[model samples]
Target chain A: AQSVAQPEDQVNVAEGNPLTVKCTYSVSGNPYLFWYVQYPNRGLQFLLKYITGDNLVKGSYGFEAEFNKSQTSFHLKKPSALVSDSALYFCAVRAFSITGGGNKLTFGTGTQLKVEL
Target chain B: GAGVSQSPSNKVTEKGKDVELRCDPISGHTALYWYRQSLGQGLEFLIYFQGNSAPDKSGLPSDRFSAERTGGSVSTLTIQRTQQEDSAVYLCASSSSAGTYYEQYFGPGTRLTVT
Candidate 1:
């Protein structure tokens, strides 16, 4: 089974300061990790994904994530937080092989990121 | 036309009433998915349709919940005898295909409030 874990329920950071939202996963095979952000009354927006490449992956809105195989983690990061960046972040993982079943994503509980001025 | 669209942005219905939500995927998207976001559950995948086939339906909570996609473009999710617990934001997403490299685009979501 493929599963994701977001340890933090909420994270608060001051505007212009760097922020990090933690995420980890467990999968049977190679993992395809993804990060998505959702604002109030809106849909989840794709941030970035890590398939098989460099350890660090950059995404939209000045966001990035680091993929650590040993730690089994893919934490989202932003060099400088913006007040408008406040939203709910979700981490998802899917296994590469679909022999057991189909390719279905397992999402984490989600972390609420609050960027204050 | 530009992005995935869902109908009935906000729906408030009495308990035990049946409600149907619609989703219009991107013009050429071959894959569509439905998810529910509740206060307690966070985000849960409900169903997924790839082209004319749905290989997975394990995420659906109960038999009362059913969904179907036609012509590989439009989808409808129907809930029978809706319960208070069913109240949540139902989101729809579409991707180019059921591939690891494809990115899923989301819709605004229909907020279903069972009162």
Candidate 2:
């Protein structure tokens, strides 16, 4: 069984400040981590993913995530937050299943990001 | 190109009724998935289909919940005798199942409200 956790329900940041949304995961095999953002009443938009590359992965909307194998964490980060960045963010994990089960993502509860100007 | 899409953005139904949610995956994408989001339970995987065959029905909550896909293009999730607890935002996503990186694109989701 694989799972993900977003400890914070909400994160508030001032404009132009750096922001981070924490995520942690547990998987039997190698963890394939991903980050997605959802605007109000909109579907989730893929942000970035960490498969088997550099620890730091860049993504859309000037967002990035650092995958730390030792910590089992993939935290979403942005150098400078913009008010438009305020939205709901989710972290998900996918693990290789020998069962041949189609890749199904296990997602976290989601963290609400609020950027104030 | 167009992204994944779901029909009936919002739905309201009474307890004991049945509801169907639809999803159209991206063209030529062989994989489709269903999920649910609610206040109590974040996002949950409901099922996964590959070329109209479901190898994983593991995430389905109960027997009352069922889903099927046809023509390898569209899918419909059905919930029978819906309970209030069943009310949630139903999300659909699809991936090409190709390459080393498999990222699923999502649809807006259908919000179901059971009374």
Candidate 3:
């Protein structure tokens, strides 16, 4: 079994300030991590993923995530936050399983990001 | 190109009733998935279909929930004897294949309300 955890239910930040949303995972095999953002009444939008290679991976909407093998974590980061960045974020993980659907993503509860101007 | 789509954006039904939700994956997609999202909760895996391989139904919460994909493009999820606890958003997603490391594009989802 594979799972992910986003410890914070909500995180608040001031405009133009750097922001981070933490995520951790537990997987038996090699892991594939992903980040997604959801606006009000909208579906989850793919942000970025960490399959392999550089620890730091860039994604959509001025967001990035650092995959730390030792820490077993993938934390999303943004150099400068904007008010429009406020939304619900989810962290998901998948391991190499033979069942189907690319080993069905297991998602965290989600984090609500609030950016104030 | 159009993305994955679901029908009956919103539905309300009473207890003991059966309902069906639909999904249309992107053209040529070979993998389709169903997940459930309750209010303020994370997505819960439901079922998965990949090409002609047998579906993975391990994540389904109960036998009352069932799904089928025909012609490898469209899928439908059916809930029997709906209960209030069954109310939630049913989301559909699709990927090019059941290969590891492929991104899954999601649909808008169908909100189901059981009274």
Indicate which candidate wins on lDDT: 3
Show the colliding residue pairs in model 3: none
Binned by DockQ into CAPRI classes (incorrect, acceptable, medium, high), candidate 3 is medium
The digit string of per-residue lDDT tens for model 3 on A1-117 reads: 688999999999999999999999999878999999989888888999999899999999889999999999999999999999999999999897665434789999999999999
Docking category for candidate 1?
A: medium
- Considering summed lDDT, which 10 consecutive residues are worst modelled in model 3 chain A? A94-103
Q: Could you tell me which residue pairs clash in candidate 2?
A: none
Q: Which candidate is the best by TM-score?
A: 3
Best-first order by TM-score: 3, 1, 2
Q: In model 1, what are the clashing residue pairs, if there are any?
A: none
Candidate 1 lDDT over B2-115, as tens digits, reads: 899999999999999999999999899998889999995778989998876644688899999999888778999999999999999999999998886567889999999999
Model 2 chain B: ten consecutive residues of lowest lDDT: B93-102
RMSD of each: 1.2, 1.4, 1.2
Question: What local lDDT score does residue A106 receive in model 1, on the 0 to 100 scale?
Answer: 80
Ranking by lDDT: 3, 2, 1
Q: TM-score of chain B, per candidate?
A: 0.95, 0.94, 0.98
